[model samples]
Target: MKKLHVVAAIIKKDDKILATQRGYGEFKGLWEFPGGKIEKGESKKEALIREIKEELNADIKIDKFALDLEWQYPNFYLYMSCYECSLESDLKLLEHMNGKWLGKDELDSVQWIEADIKVVNYLKENL
Candidate 1:
């Protein structure tokens, strides 16, 4: 199976984590950490910063690496890196239908994409 390397930002503000809902394509309406696939030759941090800016219209400072996870979807294996980030502005959901700041108790209310669901579990355990 092919593997996709994705960099995801776990943007945390006031103890709440940012979650975006997919607005288009197959995963529409499913929640995910804001990010995109890492293009060839681009560093993970670069890809993450670029993706966040493109998707949310916000600048972010990557504070630390949070979690790395791998999961098999039906068509591909997803390798993801979760990073702790701080947003430079109020988030605007350009590519997503909506977004929310979720705490541990509210985590189950959102419908997360498969790969991101694993990351969410990790956060619940570790955070």
Candidate 2:
């Protein structure tokens, strides 16, 4: 199976965290943290910054490394790094299915992609 390294941002503001829905691919309609695959020549933070700009038209400062996980999907192995981030500008979604600001208590309202469950658990415990 192909292996992919990616970064995801947990943008927390006040009582809510940002979650994005997939607009395409097998995971369409599933919610995920805002981020994408790490491109060649890009560091994890760099890839996350670039992806946020492309997907949300917003900027963020990576506050800290949150967690990392490895998961095997049907066709690939996913190595994902998660970060706690602070948004620096207004968020405007230019890509993907949908987005929402979910409170810690409301995290389970939407269906999350398989890989994001652990991150969500961490958030619930700490936030």
Candidate 3:
């Protein structure tokens, strides 16, 4: 199986977290934390910052590392590094079709993609 190195940002504001709905690909409409694959020679933090800028048209300060986990899909194995981030600017949805601000109690309300469910579970326990 192919292995992908990806990063996800848990953009937290006050008591809510940002969740974006996928507008493209195999998992369209599924919610996820906003981030993307780590490119060769780029640090995870750098890739995360670049991805947020490209996808959300916003800047973020990566506060700290949150969680690291591996999940297996039918096609590939995902190695995800999650970080807690603070948004530095307003967000414009460029890639995702919809975005929601969910409190810890509301995290389960949306249908999250399979890979992001682990992150959600972590947030449920921690937040």
Clashing pairs in 3: none
Each candidate's clash count: 0, 0, 0
Model 3 clashes, total count: 0
Q: Which numbered prediction scores highest in TM-score against the true structure?
A: 3
Q: In model 1, which regions exceed 4 Å deviation?
A: none
Model 2: per-residue lDDT, tens digit, 2-102?
Answer: 99899999998988999999998899999999899999899999999999999999999999999999889999999999999999999898878789999
The CA lDDT of each predicted structure is 0.91, 0.93, 0.96
Span of ten consecutive residues with least summed lDDT in model 2 = 91-100
In model 1, the Cα lDDT at residue 121 comes to 86
Clashing pairs in model 1? none
Kindly indicate the candidate among 1 and 2 with the higher lDDT.
2
- Expressed as tens digits, the lDDT of each residue in 20-123 for candidate 1 is 99999989989999999999999999999999999999999999999899889888898998899998887788999999999977888998998888888888
lDDT of 2 at 46: 98
12-80: candidate 3 lDDT, tens digit per residue:
999999999999998898999999999999999999999999999999999999999899999999999
On a 0 to 100 scale, what is the lDDT of residue 21 in model 2?
93
